[model samples]
Target: MGEFELIRHYFAAAPCAQGGVGVALGIGDDCALLDLPAGEQLAISTDTLVAGVHFPAVCDPLLLGQRALAVAVSDLAAMGATAIGFTLALTLPQVGAQWLAGFADGLGRMAARCAISLIGGDTTRGPLSITVTVFGRVPTGQALRRSGAQPGDLLCVGGFLGNAAGALPLVLGEREAAADVAGPLLEHYWSPVPQLQLGERLRGLATAALDISDGLLADCGHIAKASGVALQVNLAQVPVSAPLQAFLGREAALHAALTGGDDYVLAFTVPESALTTLAREVHVIGRVLEGQGVTLRDPQGQDITPVQRGYQHFRETP
Candidate 1:
């Protein structure tokens, strides 16, 4: 494709809009510019997607584009910062205008939805890889931190879990794509909507918060260690989607939900009084008590026997 065609088709587009993202000149120019607000500092994060590593090689380019940005945005969401701009660095084994078009289309779709913008990026020849760096801003003292959990705080999660793991079998051809069984789970994995608004709202109410990219048990331990408090998660209260239940029976469903990754839902802690207000956007699942570990309670009120260990990037990736 020609330079102008490439620019028009893929480079120039609006990003997701939360506060004022994509309000200024973005990509397709000599230099992208921004009108950053005064007093608020921008939070920045980056993530890379490698073929056969972060995602399957056969995955759709559109979903890859969406996921690449969504994953990076999740980091900003965890920080309670609004969307701003992003730059992409892409490495490709071969040039395919069609593939790039679909990827850009996906990127633009998400950018507009989230009010973000594609500011700048670079291209190189190599194995297929994409690195996206995002910037967001929040008022001073408003950004949430992982190290703020205190004793006696309520633990809550947005939406259900384990759908991705339950749906993995379908994506991998180990099972069929039965909508009744793993449809929503597939959607959760393909196009996870970052909970930016919820994270922003949680800034004051939540003692600590983080999106559940890793499993609940593992991510909760992050907060526990950071805050120096123990977290107790009630298994009965753990929410699972109907589709996930159908794909994996009750026992396995709960286990996968607890130990599965890529939920993108926010797992946060708030004071006891926050239960009522947060009810609109959150589901109370556990509590942070004074201690130094995480405990999962089974149905009979007895602590689960040796909770399954959570996600470890290098050691475990199945």
Candidate 2:
């Protein structure tokens, strides 16, 4: 089928593409227009997922659709911004009606959940890949950033960590487990719920914030570097789900929580005063200190930082 016809039949006709608040002009226009409220700033983020590298070359289009958009929208949540709209640039080897329909359905479901609209994007023939750009808005000077963490702030995460990492073997078909063990882990990997509400509530409270796409330690290093403060991660305090521990064992689960990436949970720093106001789901794992890098502390307060922090796209090989 032709590009225009394909888009119209699949994505353009989806419920998310119908336009919502802040989307002035949606799919048909050359440039999508967004309306921002007075004294608010527009926040945007983009993420690309390649066929083999990011995900299995052959996988469920519905899950891929949900994952692609969720990961990108996590960026907006990190900044404590309210999601507005998104644009998807899809590159496919060939058109398949069934695949498009499933993908569009999943994407539309997630967009509706996040209260975000599908704005505009493009389609082309190529190796399979999906790029989603998300738009959000936050009041001026209120958006959380990575550079504002203070020495006395407490390091925290939105929810349980490492479930997605623990699910890797299951995702790649290398391992199998009971439904009880696999259900939660696989759900986390396939459909991570971005902590948008917690992020919005953290607007003025969180000094520095970001989504943990790259393991906890690596992502926390970013906060440390940006804020010029040391982060002391208490290994004992890091939260891990029961299912993950049951699946991978305590030690392995802890390791995964520390070094495995793609959790998409919000990691941030907030003052002691703000702790009382934080949601119940927030976990306090460490504290910010007047130092240079991230330091991992054992239960007894010994340094035990791992050699491998997290995934990097390109690194020197021995």
Task: Give the best candidate by TM-score.
Answer: 2
User: For model 2, how does the per-residue alpha-carbon lDDT over 56-164 read when each residue is reduced to its tens digit?
Assistant: 9999999999999999999999999999999999999988878998888889888988999999999888999999999999999999999999999999999999999
- Residue-pair clashes per prediction, in order, are 11, 0
How do all models score by TM-score? 0.89, 0.95
lDDT of 1 by residue, 72-189 (tens): 8888888888988888888888778788878887887777767776777777778999999988888878788889998888998988988777777776777785656666777888
C-alpha lDDT score of every prediction, in listed order: 0.78, 0.90
Query: Where is the poorest 10-residue window by lDDT in model 1?
Result: 309-318
State residue 284's C-alpha deviation in candidate 2, in Å.
0.4
Candidate 1 error regions (>4 Å): 1-9, 13-25, 28-31, 307-318
